[model samples]
Target: MSKSFNAYILESRDKPLIIMAELIRKALIVRFQDKRDKMKNYVGRICPNIQKKIEGLKELSNQCIPKWAFDNLFEVKCHGEKNIVNLVAYTCTCRKWDLTGIPCKHAISAIFFKHEVVKDYVSHWYTEDTYMRAYKYIIYPIYAG
Candidate 1:
């Protein structure tokens, strides 16, 4: 006697954490490419000291995104609504916006409502100590014999 066989399949959904990581990855890649293009056309090539600052800007830019993302950002929607906009810097409720600091459509709209808050939301690496230290040192030139 012969028996017939049948197979069944199940679909899977990605977890929030996995989705957030992917978004971050995409944002980072685009940011890198844009920075590279800017560096190439940089006019500081003529000055050694200025060049160093430009080079430093390149290196610093890599680490200059933000810390709030790592820690996680939170938000609220309506006056009585629960925190719907739970877009922590790294994990946006919408997924794409949070992962990448590009700001989601919703965030962009919200920003218009609260521009000051949004401006503060943007992470600035130039304010960091490391970059400040790099700018503090004098760039004295030495003559070659």
Candidate 2:
């Protein structure tokens, strides 16, 4: 995000354009390496951030009540609202699951009713494999002239 770059801008100020550019590049490489290292220690199928979100959703799902409608279909009642969840289709009437690629509380309740793991229902884009692939390539370090 811009917040990362914004913090380095002040440090690069008063330097020549080329030097500033190199400084920013070095900063980014270090930042990326740190991220990669942090991810290496994380052991989960889904990325840590998304996993945290799922954990929060799991807690919320406990409040929902799921009723069997038909095969792969469930009617979930949560907070006085009714949401239809289709396990096979991976969809919820509330549309939160469709929008976020992560199952919403309603869908999670239905998922729990089926005795299935919520992580398996998450989109591949949030998988650890995808995340590692994104940061796999190392940035070559440039030496000072």
Candidate 3:
């Protein structure tokens, strides 16, 4: 991302401008606004990739059998193996959730068992609010002298 930003800055510097810094700021604002607009109507807090993971969890939830294991933990039986899921910790014994910031099937099941919202369990980094905050600032172009 930094590389791309640097490249953009270099490209902008090559152009004739009364104030290079102001031009670069305006360009960045436009770029960020475009990206933010695309994500403005997102269905939920998580990104598309994490949303795909959640879809997979829905399918897996149907196949797995869940047993309550005290607190926010659950023991899920899938494909003849028992995997532990701790909803509070946002972890699965399978290690998928720990490795990736997204929650795994077992954890999703545990969340379902507790009647909780899956989006609530997702990492805050994937939230729509966070995405909006990333591009919250707007930069207006300065008048060319």
Question: Which candidate leads in lDDT?
Answer: 2
Colliding pairs, model 1: 69-89, 69-90, 73-88, 73-89
Q: Give Cα-based local distance difference scores for all models.
A: 0.39, 0.91, 0.81
Superposed by TM-score, candidate 2 places the C-alpha of residue 77 at a distance from the truth, in angstroms, of: 1.0
| True-structure lDDT of candidate 3 | 0.81
Q: What is the lDDT of residue 58 in candidate 2?
A: 98
Tens-digit lDDT track of model 3 for 27-135: 8888998978978867766877678879988888777888997988889998898999988788888998888767777777777888888888888887777888988
User: Which has the higher lDDT value, candidate number 1 or candidate number 3?
Assistant: 3
lDDT of 2: 0.91
C-alpha RMSD for every candidate: 20.9, 2.1, 3.9
Clashes of each: 4, 0, 0
State, as a TM-score between 0 and 1, how close model 1 is to the true structure.
0.28
Candidate 2 pairs with clashing backbones: none
Residue-by-residue lDDT tens digits, candidate 1, 75-107: 534323323243344234555445544444344
Which candidate has the highest TM-score of all? 2
